[model samples]
Target: MARVKKPKAMNAQEKLTFLLSLVPFLIERERVSVAEVAEHFGVDAEQIREAVRLIAVSGVPGETSTYQYEDLFDIAWDDFEDNDQIVLTNQVALDDSPRFSAREAAALIAGLQYLSALPENADRTAVASLMTKLSRGASAQPSQLAVEDTGSDATLALIRQSVTAGTQLEFDYLGARGTRERRRVDPLRVESMDADWYLRGWDHLREAVRTFRLDRISNPRVSEQPISHSAGDVVLPDTLFESSAEDLVVTVEVTNSAAALLADYIPDGAAREQLEGRVRTTVRVSHYHGLKRLMAGMSGVATVVEPAEARRVVAEWAAAGAARYDGDAS
Candidate 1:
């Protein structure tokens, strides 16, 4: 008797992790059944084969097509078709376990473990599964890592239900300046960033994609009415994952650890370059003063890398603050 594997939709992060694990496993096994691999990884058989096909073409990016045959993953098509077996002839550098920095490892461990520990968590099974998947080849167990819960159990449960049901959400959202407004949102998905829970959604009144902190929401309700608009119609910006735009384009370089802090700000089209263990991130914003303040606050973790005018403005801001401090000393 054969156990049928159901196809499941995977998020970007999950798909990536699966692919990473798949490559190494295939390399080690040399020859394995597609169904067996799929069953082991909890994915459909087709997905496992598709992942191998994607890996066959993937390589380090360059100006020219410099992907060598040896660098790409090779699969035995004959064996794959005839016996439903995957034969990995080559998988360069994929056999080695990926190393994560202390910060990266700590963040994943803390985030997953905390969610799994929450007694009232609606997605406890999913969180527990993610924790196990992320801990593969890792030195530390995710259960040992912990982070404080960002929102109440009640709030998270309501948000999760609304998202799964495609229901309209009615809630009072407390804004940054302490202004509380009743908001009607088409629930998209609840996202966790830097240990904080945020409800990403289409705001009906504002006609925009907005992210509301789960902790700042009050009197949450799932409306009887379904979402009025398509999520496709409301385009969220790449950097901040919000639905807003400004004219000014800013480029900054930040340490890998600090990059997560500015994740919401980087647009999808923003050019990112890896340089000597740091990331050069470019983003467009309308508010110069706000950007300057943000850069100043980041201190040693971030620097204005381009657009000479922005650098000058930030410098002027630093000098002004320094002089004000000197005056206070006198």
Candidate 2:
């Protein structure tokens, strides 16, 4: 019998509750969807659903018993003549920074401190310095932080422009496999997730909506395609990553010599365990090649026990590696 593994991430309910706590601010300021809120907060779809529940029930008092959704926040569906979905209307803006608790302040400062570990040339140094600027109470200055300006793909800037003017775009895309492809797309909407920029659009070729990493595209021809973007359009979850598969779950047996080293490559691999100097670790990963590289890197530290295919893949790679150095230098 196999042991059930612990989750490395927050589940739906917990995430939803934490997110709902922020709703009063968004509602008071501008409209937003549960998915957008979830994406920004780094939570899951189920979590977003809960946020929607809060949004549905959330409002000041209505004139009648039934509350007006528009009066509370901008909310609606898109593609009624086409699809089933929900969306937020109107351009949203942050009313202001929320009041930070003492702990939140400290954590925020600590985050800026961590960003300072990046290379010196990062443009965000100006932004990171805001930590000290906004946080007057901090005693000392944090180290200089930096990041690369990943080729001005025009994220929030263009998003605002396109959404305002209802423009279209044509661009060359660099895909995940390092292939360059061209896409003449209908620019529907745009949003940022965890600082990464994304463009939500209708890909004519796929006959469905898709998202492209802003930085990965260049010379986007704008509004050339004759496509009308309906109001209240929201990007769906699957379009974000493009892959239709669950994270690979692999269980490995790594006794005395190596159990601790399993973490260097696995998702949130830092989790620890002890079992008679032998540990059984389970890893959740999406990329199979990455897992192969990790197994090869471990050398002899951990032995993969489950998912016969995973072990076979790693063994083949190791065998090929051995053949490369077989009977060579002394």
- Candidate 1, which ten residues in sequence have the lowest lDDT sum? 237-246
- Strongest candidate by TM-score: 1
Q: Clashes in candidate 2: how many?
A: 7
What is the per-residue lDDT of model 1 for residues 208-253, given as tens digits with 9 covering 90 to 100? 7777878889999989888875455566555434425535778899
1-330 per-residue lDDT for model 2 (tens digits): 999654346578865667556655454434455556666766665655655555555555445756564345445545211232335442122222355555556667666654443322145667566775545433333334333444543444444455445665677888655778888666665555445667777777666777787878877655644455533454465334443246677877676676545543344543445667677767765556756756765666677777989989888888887887885642
Evaluate model 1: give its lDDT: 0.73
TM-score of each: 0.42, 0.34
Looking at model 2, which ten-residue stretch has the lowest summed lDDT?
A: 88-97
- lDDT of model 2, residue 213: 73
